[model samples]
Target: MGDYLKKACCLLFALTTLAAASPVFAADVLHIQPKQHDCGLVDEGVPATMTAVVENVSGRDVHVSSVKTN
Candidate 1:
């Protein structure tokens, strides 16, 4: 029974590791360029704008529900 329990634990660990390392779990469905941008300086009441390109690399039509920015 002890050996069976040890084997079960090892099998569970191996499955968990394999699932975590799978590309399907790690691959990003959307690719974003220039993840971050720095605007040197801005005056009060002034607006600064930055542009980023987002592409879908998953080879499937993806509907963007919403977008948010900080």
Candidate 2:
């Protein structure tokens, strides 16, 4: 069906544009050391602190607004 094909093309284009506009697509511009870390044998209710190195290799100025921990 011609109408169905036209709709499918439009949907694909919209999805592609959405992906390109997302910040997740630009994540590769930064290099983060120690992508994963292990804090071993931590007691409950105690705080643990770790440091991560972030480098910008994208040849463009990048501002890091925040950092999150899990």
Candidate 3:
């Protein structure tokens, strides 16, 4: 009984401290738009330019570290 009560109190205090000290991170919203282009066919030894327009609607600074395709 006493052990359980002590554990619960310690857990509660730890949670409260963490919540008060931690900073709330806001979500970042970004919009990506691609330009229109016409390509007849994709074949070997073909050159293409991929253009994208990225917009930050979150009103915050966004860092683009890297980009990859699957």
lDDT of 1 at 59: 74
lDDT of each candidate versus the true structure: 0.71, 0.74, 0.65
**Across residues 8-61, which tens digit of lDDT does each residue of candidate 3 receive?**
999999999888766443222444445454555667888654555555655666
lDDT of 1: 0.71
Local error of candidate 2 at 66, Å? 0.4
Give the poorly placed runs of model 1, Cα more than 4 Å off.
Answer: 23-54, 57-70
Worst 10 residues of 2 by lDDT: 31-40
Error of 1 at 50 (Å): 23
Question: What is the C-alpha local distance difference test score of candidate 3?
Answer: 0.65
Clashing pairs in model 1?
none
Model 2 agreement with the true structure over 1-70: per-residue lDDT tens digits: 9999999999999999898888676676665445556556677798876665555556777788888867
Winner by TM-score between candidate 3 and candidate 2: 2
